[model samples]
Target: MAAYLKARIDLGTLEAGNKLPPTAALMKQFDLSDNAVYRGIALLKAEGYVHSQQGKGVFVSDRRRLIAGANRIKGITSPGESIHHKLSARVEAPDWVAADLGEGECVNRVRTVNRGDFILQASQSWVHLDVAEVVPEVDEPQACDPTWQAIYEQRSGNPVGVASKTVDARITSAADREALGLDADFAVLVMRSVYVTGDKVIGVGEGVYAPGHPLAIA
Candidate 1:
């Protein structure tokens, strides 16, 4: 489906904000089962290639933003640690989610922790309802041991092949302040990223880190 989506996207058949064919339509087109179609979109959603709504339909997300955002994950090293590149997965729905999921849409909280010290918080907002529904495990607590390898392998039944990251600076919004345990003094480093395979986008994520935890982008 990533190939199909990419082909369409590259050919201008699908542009940013364009709605993808419904699951039923895609099922018929690809001759796939319900589970296959659903998992494909879930993989796309996780990779930031698309966004799906409850009653509406699936659509293309800003892939440029996704591509640019992937640059931020360059250096995982913090002051005390060489590179604390641990992560944890969860399912959570939040109201204050951002607009990346095609305006007025929201996503669940996917809090990723790096080691036992630096904490990275993200509200994953592009998941479709169908994909979100199938995710059985939701709402993970603050994880002390963060690892994305096991979780990704289990969710998609494949190991991650490649990942791209983007890094930029952002203000601490009211929601960010509350969620990340930030005070008025701290600014956040916005890390946008996409994890990909040969023909699939496995994960698309945006993380905000507190001020003291400097993100080395060069």
Candidate 2:
């Protein structure tokens, strides 16, 4: 099942913002176990190939398109060197993200990077305002570059800790396009990450990215 999806992604048959077929349809098409289908999506989400929302459907992520199907997984912590390119620290943070992160307290770090002039915009997100004091250095944690990585690692030290995430695909709202510096034709990749720390819900983080940017998953 993983190999099949990998083939599709590699062939550009499934680009960023391309919604996956509905669960039942997918299961029927592949004649897969409900568990297998769910597990495949879970792997894709962790690798940053897809993002999910509660009511919305799963969608491909910008990073998924950027790397041309790089097989990276998101939210896994490694003690070695970083796998992702360093995002420029100067990306402007948006104000409307407060609603996206939902209540409590949130941090939005946006940046437009250049590889000698090519521009790529990205957002590093974090939530769980309730744990603000508990983890003061949310803005810049050496162990965790992405907000989701920081929260997941701080809460669960295991690099293999499992997470259940959903992916959604939607036309880019005017505000989303403007914020990501994308055009009306572009779509936003929304991922809702639910962290489970030893069978207990520790926190939830959302990762949003525009097309053409590859998501860095360990």
Candidate 3:
């Protein structure tokens, strides 16, 4: 179905910047099952051929997918996409976070990447007290902007010195599934990162990306 649609798009049968046929319509026309139709559409999206806009349906796109490296994973946003973040206000640090950054009250950050109403990726991170002290932006109560590493450098004048990332596939947690709007407990690509600046370990974060997501590599 993806190949067929690509061919149609190539031939101008499905013009660029036009909405694709509705899922039901595509299912009928291609004689494919519902899952098959969605899978085909997902493939098109991963390849930068299309994007889903929640209630607006899928549309053909001529833009390239945003490419990110391991360091830029949490900041990946395609052209014209929106990002929503939630920052917990002065919460007790989680045990695991304390294990890494010592015992103290810390802030939790959840960043959701969206296109129209469709969610693309979800990243949840905890801020260390030192980082929060250096960068007050982390302490904002209603932070809705997905943050990149450079924010720290720009705000604190401390460059990101060394970084480490652990990438794996894991069963989706209930929280992540809800955030990503998945109907089932599918496996997701996960990346946990730690950033060190000078002699201080500034921050650590985890990013949850959909399998085969175009920007998942970062």
Candidate 4:
């Protein structure tokens, strides 16, 4: 039932901000009791498909429209976004980080991004030692205002040309669930990003986002 409703939203039959039929009408159409109808809506809500208002009923969420589809991701921070949490330091590269950036010490920046009060996703980035050395602020993180991508381009005499991204769907880790404030285990979208400037790759990043969260490829 939830999938049926989601299909409608995705196909634009329901459209964003469209109010759902009354609960009883939905129950009747689906041949479900009140509890079953509610359960369906609850599932949809978890997937960022719809939202309930105090007295206005359920409606499609605009967030789903701006989101990335097929699990593809981009770390383009929109205006008004902020860093919910961040930790930056120099550390030995993890195996995955080494695979992308090489087997050496790198500046690790771990951060959780927020849109308004909503937690968006958590990402861990590994930067080439040279970039961090030249841009000392790279080791001391700040707001998500200027994306790490933007920082990598600023005053380095080279402009970022392309960003490559790959994504995988996997089980959410306990630590990440805590970071995203999830109360239960759910599958998450794991995204890997490599940023390139001139002919050199400057950094690699991995981000974890909750299910139903909108994908950003901007």
Mark the regions of model 2 whose C-alpha exceeds 4 Å error after superposition.
1-103, 108-121, 140-162, 198-202, 212-218
Residue-level lDDT for 71 in candidate 2: 30
Candidate 4 accuracy as lDDT: 0.72
Give the per-residue lDDT of model 2 (tens digit) for 160-216: 222565566667777566555565667666655554445544354445555765543
Global Cα lDDT for candidate 2: 0.51
Q: How does each model score on TM-score?
A: 0.38, 0.39, 0.56, 0.56
Steric clashes per prediction: 14, 17, 0, 2
lDDT of each model, Cα atoms only?
0.52, 0.51, 0.67, 0.72
Tens digits of per-residue lDDT, candidate 1, 1-218, equal 65677545533346568898887888899999889999988887876678887788888875544542223232122233323323333433233222222233222434544435545554342332333343433223322112232344446666543355566787788977765665675667876655444455534566777667533443
TM-score of 2: 0.39
Q: Candidate 3, which ten residues in sequence have the lowest lDDT sum?
A: 63-72
Residues 18-71 of candidate 4: C-alpha lDDT, one tens digit per residue: 999999999888899999999999988876778999988999875423344222
- Output the TM-score of candidate 4: 0.56
Residue 32 accuracy (lDDT) in model 1: 91
